[model samples]
Target: MKKFDVIIVGAGLAGLSCGLQLSSKGKKLLLLEREGVVGGRTSSYNLDGMDVESGFHRYIGYYTHLPRVLRKAGVELSEIFMWEEKIHVRVNDEKPLVLGMAPLFGMIKTIKGLVGNRRYLSLKDKLSLLPFFMNGLKDYVMSPHKLDQHSIKEYAAKYNVTNRAFHHLIVPLSSGVFFLPPERYSAYVFFGLLAPTIPKFYKMRVGAYLGGMTEVMCQPIADQIIKNGGSVRTHSNVESLVIEEGKVKGIRLEDGQVYRAQHTVLAVTLYTAKKLLKPVFENHPWFQPMFQLPLMPAVSFQIEMTKPAVPIDVTTFAPFTCLSSFAEQSRTTFQASKGRLSIILSPPEKFLDLDPQETLQFIIKDARKIGLDLESNILDYRQVNHEYDFHSLEPGFQALRPTQRTPVEGLILAGDYTRQPYFATMEGATLSGLKAASLIK
Candidate 1:
């Protein structure tokens, strides 16, 4: 029985950003979430006396909007410290090779390392990345919509990028961040990521929130939304959309409470949006595309040890390994040295169906490849799986995604999966949220 100018479902990055923007623009909005806390996957939890994120999250300097959104919430980017961009990629049983990404000219240094990497990449493999390097940063990241729709695997084959190149270089890079391998992703997404960081390729400038992402990013957004006269309700689930004559009427919650609004923003993940909106608005243009988009499942391993051994800020293991990216974040996650704590991001194939104890033990065994161990010094550990995360760009599936503004009247979509210039990521989530709010602005 509540009424507002706008009703936002799911207080994730997209929903929170949309609510904050709408409220600041003098609009009355109600933000609802099924969970007691907000921020979606960006949320963090305290474990072993340290703040551990849901997954390994790092802010690339190329993300132009994340900084702006944080500043609007009275936070400064300087609050977080920049990490030197040194990536260690281990290929099979061979020793890990380190890529130094600092000065603009340092790209050549890393390329030389790859070329000389006889066991992993060679001169031919290094030359195969010419297409990835040819696209200018502006064109690749901003204008990738027009590229011929092709799977990243297919595109790599056309360029003669060998499997060795893929297993050692491309897979770790693409799947490390995107969750799916080159075969499932679109070439545009590959270029979308390579465009921003490859030319100058300064990974050292990446930043992590000074006090965890939720406390520093999501909490501030929620605080601003409330300060602007908006109401954020947690543990409130909307069962279905109230539809009549192809237009959104309101929403009916699972508890039989009907909340009415002039406009409704479905800012949840793609899966939840499809479940709620399809049956209600079957004929809407957004319906068919929702089915085409996919979802991916992943797990994170949090390891607490008595001492520090893993020194790299961000490192990607080989494609054959169970882990994709590993980060040791004691500097940002704790008040002081609370023993060396690390986060391991892995694809579903690595930890699927494994119990928490089994998952933790498995990762510990795998960590030995990189000289990281917690078997003896293990103080605490936790494993989490994100069941409803979006599917990475699967072949031609990326093109079928709908934009933020749906064809249906009074309905707007906000999620990383919604078609946007940025790749599906936290930045994409923020942009999608802003785009949704702009529709009502």
Candidate 2:
């Protein structure tokens, strides 16, 4: 048994962010990770002499608070390149529409790309999406508490969204964030993220590191924690929280090691959080909402290319199979010359049960819609699958989401999936970690 000021569970984004914030306060802490490494799902790995990422993630301008945290951690903004946000969307086999997001001042081009194309969203569909898109989310800002009960599908019906709009604009965007289709996820979470509460802050730039996200961000932050007198242990899978009298006294690892702390931050995924806290969650009123938060699987695929495949950078899909997002990520990483391409596909429900060969083939076929020819690539590759990660942005879960401050005296929650206005993203995770750390002192 060991004792510390705090025992942080799961070294993912929320855990690391919480540790970073606490370290700045001069609090001694321990970050425990189950895997062999410290980087979370967002972290990258070396595959076949090429650096590929856990997922193709970008730092969106609307993230608002992440830049400040990175600066404090000594991460140089110059190392991150702000690529023009050109999202090439493929609606079925039709022509892919490229929408430039860059500094996020591209609303007109975005509307023109989709609405003007009139292939994805028709004039009728734009008229339907008008009330929601008008003023860029004014209604959501006006009544922040409303629309949680309405799914995107239900809300779209009021606007009479066409099948093309539902499949192309609605489902693709909905699954991109919520991991569920528009019919399944809530309309409020969608608007809350896309609809800017602070237009000044929300209207920023989207960027990626010139190197691996792990090498550039996660590992650097981990080193910062060590520099600030905090301990981080990998291969330390935490089994459960040592709760007594409705308070978290510490945590127990799978190997039977016990680490005691005055405060504990359970920063694992939403599914893992519910599982670990099941003993209390089944009974506690405040914790009961943990069950309301549904879990969804996330899968990432990558391939090394001997020759250039897709000329464009990124493409999101929904014109065919369950919605998916894919990108030729080699351009951003320090290992750009290696020509690494990757994609973050949809639910385990659609492909989780498929064999590895079948899965790879499926993704390759999907990528071809945007002119991505991974099969022609002549090098090594890899795939990463997690049983759960994202939270359901679905209807009725808004009122159920718990905040960073928990009912237990020494316990707190920190994760992208936890209650955050940002939804399940790096922004939500960063903010959650900040709030969790603040709650302790």
Candidate 3:
């Protein structure tokens, strides 16, 4: 048996970030994964000579931690370029409307509702949020319980802001990023996102890599983790976590080897984490129910065109299907033979029943409606269905997610599902991983 200070399971973005942070502190670590690669969904692949990602993944300039970590790993940020944010929303399938920061008119109405009517912002709820926007808005992100107990939609409804503006604008925005509809998420999580997004922050433009997210972020970070004395073992699945006296001691691989460690980080998705920790929390009824937190799926259609006709090169959000967001990436390379366009679609949970062909048609129709040419410039296509993108953050989910420190000592939890401020995204994963490592001695 091999032993180390920490053994991290699932070297996804979250695990990798935790590994990097812990290893940098001189902690001996062993990172394991069930896949051949490290990136969970953030990694990219070359499909038929075109670089593609699992879904629409990108980095925002305001993600200070991501850029700083990449720089520390010896990566050049200049390699990645920022694209102007090109997001849009449609109300009831009418013309897609372009929007500016905060959807000013919608926000104004929300503010008015909050002030004029008791139905908009309840007396009790007002007490919770008013302080943040009035006397304490600047430092609200630092608060742990701003919306800790209430759902985002509940907050909006309480303020009488659940109109078409809230649904098409706020719902799509939050749901697309978090995989949870606004009506079901915690107000605190929403507040956390709003805290960082000032006008200055939005003006930097939502950014993407010149190539793919893998090249710009994940790959470079993997190089750094290996260099920092941490081992990233892909395709090494942990069948069982060996614990001693309620403390994680090691993990037994499916292939029959036992790698021991002082601490273990379960950085798999929420569903996976539930199974791995089941043995430890089997007797606890609370934990069993906690394991069943609702989840949403993510699907994407990657199209590599034989030729280009339209000059559409921006990410957009469609507010129709409880659908989250759509991102169009232009892969214009010097050696490129044809135009490479990637469309990431986050359909609502109910839409999971549709097959790829149906999804393609649906997206194509929507694309045409949104002023993009989808019929002419087409070659080959690829689709991915991530059934477990995020746990459903519906009302009453705030109290269900696990924490970084679990009932089992040394068996830490790390994933976007675990008490993260955001529901599910690259940033959320990174933050969850970083938080897990902080729990280490």
Candidate 4:
């Protein structure tokens, strides 16, 4: 039996962030991961000398804590990410609508860029959205929790937002970002995330990593933890929590290896955390709400094209299509991935059971509707599916999210699913980790 001051299970963003913070504070730590690599959802793998990501990931400008944590790990945001000022939304049989941000040109230019798409948004359509926007900002100041009972679609309807605007704007945002349809996603979570960026809307830019996430981001954090005299063990599958007298002692591995610690942080996925805790803390009040939290499956495709399909590196969204969002990676981040289309499939329930070839056919059909001839430019493709991808932000789910601190003395939870201002995003995960670290000692 080995002993340490703290033991963190799962080496994802949450675990890595927690480990780095605790290790830096001079606490002897041991970080364990079941997979060979560190980044859980934010990881990348090598395919025939080319790096392929688990899914399409983007960094929103509103992210504050994540960048701070990265800086502590000796990484500057600009060094690894390329920023884009425009967002593209493709409507079937029509040209892609562009939403631009002119930060240097100031707020007037930014507002014009946002509402200037007269081609898709009419005067009435734009006017109808005022109630939602006003309420979103107002709710942010008061409490977004009051709106948690309504879905995005329901909220829009309640505010009398026109269907054209709803289809063009809300549908794409809900499906593209959360992989959930507007009818299913919570309005509070959506607006809560948007409200913070309104003040900095002109400065809001989306960023893409320049290289593999594990190499440029996760590895540096892991190295920093090790450099601080902490141990990071990969391929270590924790079987169960070691509990004695209602307090966490440590964890026991699948191979029957015991590692004890004064405090233990389970920074795994929501599903994994439920599985580990249900045996012991299933009926506990703090944990009971967690059982009601839903899980979402994610499927993403990496399509290598003979030629570039998209001209720019900006993210493109096609509402009502199988695609959530996609980008030309060769132009955006990795030069080796030139002509590669990194696509995330939305409403993932439909594609979960289909084989890769069948899945590609559906995508090809949808691509044609949005003016992309994927069939003619065939090369190679890879599909990555995560069974328990994320925690679903369904209406009423906001109240279900548990806090980082639990009733158990030494047992802590850390993940994007935990209570946080942000949704299941990188910022949320980083914030959860930092909150978990603060609970210790």
Ranked by lDDT, the better of candidates 1 and 4 is 4
Which stretches of candidate 1 lie above 4 Å from their native place?
A: 46-51, 92-95, 102-124, 131-150, 162-164, 198-204, 283-285, 335-337, 340-345
lDDT per residue (tens digit) for residues 1-441 in model 3: 788999999877889889889988888889998877668777766766655677766566566656666777777766766554444554433445554332232454334444534432245544554433432333344544455566667666665553644655566666666655665666666666666666434334465666656666776777788888888888898898897877788899999999998888999988787778787777866476567786766666677676642345455565554335654455532115355555556445544677757776876776665566667777767776677766765555656777787666778889888877555666678888999999998
In candidate 4, stretches whose alpha carbon ends up further than 4 angstroms from where it belongs are 47-50, 101-109, 140-143
Work out how many backbone clashes candidate 3 has: 8
Q: Rate the local accuracy (lDDT) of all candidates.
A: 0.73, 0.73, 0.67, 0.86
Ranking by TM-score: 4, 2, 1, 3
lDDT, candidate 4, equals: 0.86
Instruction: Find the candidate with the highest TM-score and give its number.
Output: 4
lDDT by residue (1-441, candidate 1, tens digit) is 878899999988899989988999889889998876788888876755645677767777667667778888898777754454557786544567766555453556556565566656677777777764564234455656544266667766766777777677777777776666667767777777666665445533556556667777888889999999999988899999988787886888889999888899999988898899778766755577777677777777776666654554454555555666766666665435455454545556567678878877667667776566568877777776777677556555667777887778878999888878666688889999999999995
lDDT of 1: 0.73
In model 4, how large is the Cα lDDT of residue 376? 82
Q: What's model 3's lDDT at 112?
A: 48
Q: Which window of ten consecutive residues has the lowest lDDT sum in model 3?
A: 131-140
Worst 10 residues of 2 by lDDT: 314-323
Provide TM-scores for the models: 0.88, 0.89, 0.81, 0.96
Please write out the lDDT profile of model 4 over residues 1-441, one tens digit for every residue: 999999999888899999999999999999999988889989987766556888879998878888988999999898999987777889885788876643643455457656688989999998999998898668756876778888989989989999999998888877788888888988887888788687766558888888889889999999999999999999899999999999999999999999999999999999899989999987788788889888888888888888887777878899978888888888655676548898889878888888989999999999999988888887888888887968878887787888999889889999999988887899999999999999987
Candidate 3: clashing pairs of residues = 120-158, 120-159, 120-160, 132-137, 147-188, 152-185, 153-183, 294-392
Residue 77 displacement in candidate 3 (angstroms): 2.6
